[model samples]
Target: MPETSLPVFIAPPLRLPVRTIGRRTFDFSRQVAVMAVVNRTPDSFFDQGRTFALDAAVQAAVDAAEAGADWVDIGGVPFAPGPELSAADELDRVLPVVQALAAVSDVVISVDTFRPEVAAAVIEAGAGVVNDTTGLHDPRLADVVADSGATLVVTHSLAAPRRPHPRPHYDDVAREVADLLARRVDVALAHGVREDQIIVDPGHDLNKTTVHTLELTRRLGEVTALGHPVLAAVSNKDFVGESLDRAKPDRLAGSLAAAVASVFLGARIVRMHDARAAVDAARMVEAILGWRRPVHAVHNVS
Candidate 1:
């Protein structure tokens, strides 16, 4: 096998102080976090609304938490190019799930949205994090997060909500992504969001081609160098499918590989559809890298 070229620029050691999200606090530096995806939308790229019903969505969140996911990201709208969803409709879709999960689960709750109204509603409903995939397209989203004392995940996406960016071009995909995330972090900070309450995602496949996403993964340390916890949402994305020449249902291996690679490159959190597999992969990686202690070391320890 050919040797891969990883980033040579050494970032400072990951030093993510504990961040409070609602009643939960996470110290991201010690181990990788697996964030399970729970989409309540009928048109989500993967799962295709299997969890769209309120009962199913709530059950999915509970299952993810029980499967060892540290976080559950519930989304009302799909990020793909599609008809826009009104804030009211989005709220109607996600609020019940968030409320249910928050009431019963100690697992951190994140609402994936870009609208300030939706963010505010979910935060009020006990969501600990507001995941803005629009890259802060609406600045007021940050305001809502700040006011509610919720964590904010600012992703780097150039397109407007539910809009497509055709033929996207970037001089340096990783650098540009890092820069955009930095700017978004600044925006969040200026909006009164605490620095520790921020997480950054490079938005793999969000306005990026397969090659772009691969390059971003290759150099994800640049984004992690920004001093905030990096969230890699590499689960069953189109880029992984395109890279491995596999369909969405068949991309589990590719997604897990990409997710592990992201963690190796310094991503502190991984968002994934298969929570159990992802949690195992993350724990294995952390253990191999000496960041996590083995749950029980036995046979070879003699």
Candidate 2:
């Protein structure tokens, strides 16, 4: 028997034209959005609870919106392996902040939680998106997003709640992640979540090693090929730290590089801790790729 070799797949242009999160509608084909990360948890990896206080969280959201962030992703619990947080505690942590931000700003609000109850509560509290970093471990979460008519960001991770897969092995990291996200998208669609409301994330560092995350970034178009707007949350992650041999605070440069690379590779939304920097980088990439026009065109034109 002779073996046949297939050609490598080249992705078509992303078909996600319009994404309506909360009351804001984005033309994904033309605009790349910077989603500011607002962690209301005391143990989040980046800010380390800087915005854990209600006032601080609200102010951070407002500040990010003012700084050009298109969306603000608020999280009540850290995704790192940690002690279990009660659902009520999680609700208390994020609901007030979501309520306050919804009242003050029109930035698309997203709550990073995998709990259906938390997703429902936050949507009722004015959140327009539910970002499940757990890869939709609970199918009920999809139901909640569907019922609320909120957008859903499904990430691919091979871990349960508060559990760690320290060493993960995948034959093809990007391909496997894309396949997983495709399945998740199918589940969401079957559960009544509209196709246009779904966004996919490859879950960088969630259950991957540094090399795996790098490979995923390099081949991000494979994930975007699924016809959904891809979201990359590579802000100050451990993979960036390990790749650059730098500490958490020093990985901003690496994070920015990865974010820009992801956007160039067709990621529509970038989740970042530094909203202003990320917004600048994303806009620069968009402009270079002709997706966006320069603000001022008077440099050297005759």
Candidate 3:
């Protein structure tokens, strides 16, 4: 009997179209876009007050672009334990950087804040995407997105009480987060945000322990299965640092590993700090796994 050659299984390269804060469309199928972090606050965990000066801020954005970041995410306040900056204050802190970046480069300028006023102001200044750490809480936020025609990254987080309170709870973290995200999508839809303009991040370090973060990473396929592109933000996060026994600055390698793993598990966009390293690693993974659609023909790769 003659032995027949078994057919090799090659998954098609996953291509996602993200309409960015730049008001232009990018093809993620071509490469994993790197999002450089630019914190304008005095208390951001890693680079707090690192760019208080406008020159420093502009330089940071320029450096991110030079370092191979496909986009630059500028935030006014620290996400850690601190007082949230007011909308006007936030606008003042970040709009200059956004305007500067928009003037110099065509790179995507993402404003990381939940305040609708701030989001509107920054987008008006030429920022493209609204990365809301608060998962669609302010109903008015949806209106801002619709009005500005900017893409939205709606990440998951537990609802906080009005009064100062203790940490929230999640009995089944994955299911609860997924449910909350599903509701968030419904909320956005109700408020007039288009489906294609939405991105869902499972809120990697926020309101989650190391075990929870690990579980979410393993189940990212489940999150992406919800029918929206996934943005995995595993850059220098507490869980990654704590898991690897490394300091914040030393967490780049760990973050890169986590980003690679998350993308392999079904993340479409990776929000990261080390843009060049992350983008190169993701491209290599895509190459090694043969995860790309043939440009000339769809059936050619298979």
Superposed on all Cα atoms, model 2 deviates from the true structure by an RMSD in Å of 5.8
Which portions of model 3 show Cα errors greater than 4 Å?
1-23, 161-168, 291-302
TM-score, structure 2 vs. true: 0.94
Using lDDT as the measure, the top candidate is 2
lDDT of all the models against the reference?
0.88, 0.89, 0.78
lDDT of 3 by residue, 1-302 (tens): 23333222211123335445474566554346678888887877787587877788889899888886778999887655566556788788899999989998988889998888888888888988999987877878889998778889989876441223245466877787888898998899888898877889999978788888888888776787676777888999988988989998899889999998887776767888776787677767765555553335556667
Model 1 Cα shift for residue 264 (angstroms): 0.8
Worst 10 residues of 2 by lDDT: 3-12
Kindly give the stretch of ten consecutive residues in candidate 1 with the minimal lDDT sum: 3-12
Q: After superposition, how far is residue 257 of candidate 1 from its true place, in Å?
A: 0.7
TM-score of each: 0.94, 0.94, 0.87
Q: How do the candidates rank by TM-score, highest first?
A: 2, 1, 3
**Candidate 1 lDDT, 93-128, residue by residue in tens:** 999999999889889999999999988888888888
lDDT tens readout by residue for model 2, 1-302: 23333222322366666877898999887688899999998898888889999999999999999999999999999999999999999999999989988998899999999999999999998999999999889999999988888999999999998898877999999999999999989999999999888999999988999899999999998898898888999999999999889999899899999998887787889999999999999899767666667899998897
**Number of clashing pairs per prediction, in order:** 0, 0, 5
